[model samples]
Target: MAAEQQAPSILGFPHRPEWGAAAHRRAVAGYLRRCRDHARIGARQAARCIGTSESTLSRLETGLAPLKPVEVERLLDVYGVRDPAERQRITLLVAEATQPESWHPYAHAAPNSLRPLLAMEPAARRIISYEPQLVPGWLQTEEYAQIVIRATHPTLPAKEIDERVRLRRARIDMLRRRVDPPVLLAVMDSEVFRRQVGTPGVMYRQITYLLTLLEDLRYQLRLHIAPLSVGAAGAIGHPIVHLRFFAPEYLPDMVYLEQYEGAVYREKPSESERYLAVLNHLCGVATPADQTASLLRQALDTWR
Candidate 1:
C-alpha cells in the first residue's frame, strides 16, 4: 500500500497532473499540524499518543514522510480531531493521496516538486497568472509549445519533447473535466507574440488559438496583453502564478514563482499578497482582456 501511485491517463502517457495526490499529502500534513497546535500538544506527546517516535512525527509534519491511511486515522485520533466531518474530509484526501503522480515519468526533465501546482490547479476557484517571457503553458498550441520546449530544452531528445507535449496537451484538456473550472486570468506581454518561436506560421497559429479562446466567454479565460509601452510596470523577469483555494482548510492560497532551477511557492499571507499586488498593478496598466483579441490579430498579421 506504500507503493507510489502511477495512475494511467487516457492521454496514454502519464499526463495527469500529479497534484491531486500531492494535495492529499499536503492536506494530511496540514490537518495534523492544526490539530496538534490547537490542542497545545508537543510532537513528542503526539508521537506517544500515536505510537510513533518523535522524529517520525516531525518528519510527517514537515512532509518528509508519507503517511499510510492507518497512520492518518491513528494520528487524527491521537490529536483529538474527533469531528466526523473533519475526519471524513481528511479521509477523502487519503484516498486522493493514493492516486499515482503523473510527473514521475518526467522527473528527469522537471526535477522540482511541482506536484503542488498540479494538485491545486484542479481544485482552485481561480488562477491569476502573469507570463512575461512567453505564452502560459495552458494557452499554447502544439506547435507553439514545441518551439518553446526546443529552445529552452535544447539537450532533450525528440522523444522526450514529444512525450511532454502530449502530456501538456492532456493537462489543457483537464480543465474541461472539473465541475466548476477555475477562472483563468492570464496576463502576458506582447513581445511573446512578436518574437519568432518556430516560424511566422507557428506564431500565427498560436495567435489564432489565443483569439479563439478570447472569444469564447464560456471558457472562463480572461487574457490581457501588456504592451511594450507598459514596460516593467506589468511584468517581472519570471512567470508568476497565484492560486486561490475554495477550501482554505484543505488547500491554501499560494503564489508560484517559476525559476530556471525550479519553482518557488509562497504561502504566507504576507508574502503571497505582494505577488497579488503586482498582478493588480499589471491589470491596471495593461490592456483589458476584452481588447486583447485585436492586439493578437495585429501581431498575427505582422507575422504573415
Candidate 2:
C-alpha cells in the first residue's frame, strides 16, 4: 500500500520571494526544547523515538535545520501528551512558525526583527491606524516627527536621526501619490496633541499641522480623547496599525501591533478578530471626534 502524502513544508507564506523561514525554525525549536525539558527526556532518547540521530535532533532544536511536521508529531506522541486540544494547538503553531514571513526583506530599513504585517500596499482597500501617544507616522509633520525622533533616539548621532526622520516623512507621501491609495483612517487620543515633546513653538506648529491635515478630504481623521473618568482605559497601550486588503487569495485583514522594543504582525484569524474587538470597544469609550478636536484646540491655546 502507498503511504499518504505528507503536508507541504511551509516554503513561503503570502508567496513572497525574500521570506524568512528562520523565525519559524527558531519558534519550533524552542517548542521542542521546552517539550523535551517537560518530559525529562534526553535528546538521544527522543531522537531515537523520532528516528533521527541525536545530533540531528540537537541541530533541529537549535534551529540549524527545519523539523518535518511528521517528526514534530512523533516527538509529541513520544512525550505521552494526551490532551487533544494541546496536540492540535502545537501542530498548528508548528505550521504557522514554519510559514515564512513574506515581509522580512522590507524589514531591512526598519529593525530586522520586526514582524511587520505589510502586504502589497498598492492593493489595500482601507488602512486604519490608531495612536494614543504620538502622531501616527503617516500624519506626522516633518518638524514634529523630527522632534520625536530626536528625543526618543538621543543615542543616535544627529545626522542619522535626521535621515531616519526624513525616511519617515517620505513614507507619508504614499498617501497622496498612490493611484488608488487606501482610504486613510486615523484615530488619535486627545493626549497625543497635548503631549509636548518639543518647544512650545514647535507644539503650536504641530497642532496647526494636524488642523491642516484635517482639511484634506481624503484624510479621515477622527481624533478623540479618553476621559479621566475612564482612568487607565484611556491610556494607550501599544500602537495598533490595522490593514484591510481586497485580495482573493489569503490576503484579507491584518493587524500590526507595535511595542517600543519589538513589533509583531498578527494574521491569525482569532488574533485579528480580537484586535478588531478591542478597537471597537476603545472607540465606543472615547469622546467623539469633534469634541476631541475641540480639546486639542483648547490644549493648543493653553500651550503658550
Candidate 3:
C-alpha cells in the first residue's frame, strides 16, 4: 500500500520586496512558532509529533531550514491550530514551494536566488533584450566584462571578481549548444554603443565583437537600435528582457524581471500579458534589425 500524504499548508502571500524566498521561509517559520507556543509545546514534544529530531524542529522554527509541507501540516495539527485563515495561508505556501524553481540550484546561499530562474529556464523560443547602461552579459567581451564587473563590485576581492567573470563567460557557451538555438533580438540605446566603458581598447574590441556576432549565421541573432527619441515613449527601463519558452503543453508565457539584488519570474498570465505589451511598444518604435546592423557598422567605424 502507498503511504498517505499530509494536508498542505496555506501559501498565497505577496513576496517581500527584498529577500523573496528567504522572507517566505522566515514568515512560515514564524507562523509555525506561534502555533507551537499557543499549544504550550516544547521543542522535543513538537519534534516527536512531527517524526523529526528536536534539533531539526529547532532549526526549522528558527527559520534556518526551508519548511516542508508535510512537516507544516503535522506540526499544525499536533498544535491544534484551528484558524481557517491561517490554514488557508499555509496551504498556499505549500503550493508555492512545489512550483518549479528554474534558478534554485545556481543561487548562492545568500539572497540571489533569482539568478537561477533565467539560467534554468527550458531553452527559450525567443529572447528580446535591451540594455542602455552596459553591454549585456551574454554579448560582453572578456576585457569589457572585467572592467564592468570590477566597477560594479568594488568591495569584492580581485580573485572573486575573476571567478565571477569566468563564470559569466562560460554561460555564453549555452548559445551554441542546440542545433537551433533561441532567436536573439536586442536593442540598445545609441549612446550606450558610443560610450567607452572599460578602456578605449576594450571599448573598440567589444564593438567589433558585436559586429562579428551579427554575421554569425548559425545563431539566428538580430540587433536593433532604440534611439533617444524612443526613450520619450517610455522605452527606458533597466535591461528589459522578454523570453518565450516553447512549452507545447502550457498556453501561458513566462516573464522574468531582474534587479541588482534579485529577480522575479512571473508565470501569471496577467504579468506575461503586461510584458508582451511593453515588448510590442519597444519593437514598434525601435529601428529595424538591418538598420541597426548599419548603425553598428557606423559605430565601429567611429571607434576606429
Per-model TM against the reference: 0.85, 0.59, 0.62
Q: What is the full ranking by lDDT, best candidate first?
A: 1, 3, 2
Clashes of each: 3, 1, 14
Residue 36, candidate 2: C-alpha displacement in angstroms: 32
Point to the candidate with the largest lDDT: 1
Per TM-score, what order, best first? 1, 3, 2
lDDT for each of the candidates? 0.74, 0.63, 0.65
Please give the RMSD of candidate 1 to the true structure.
7.9
Give a tens-digit lDDT track for model 1, residues 22-121.
6556667776776677667788888887788999988787555777888888877766666666676667666776776655555554445465676567
lDDT, candidate 2, 1-304, per-residue tens: 1322222122222322222344345545656676677678898899998888999999888666666889988887777666776666566656755664444333443454333333234334566677878888766777888888777667877776666666566555545643545566666666676677778888888777777666663354455556555556656577887766543232446688887767777767789878777776666777776665566677788566
Return the lDDT, model 3, position 260: 71
Model 1: per-residue Cα lDDT at residue 288? 86
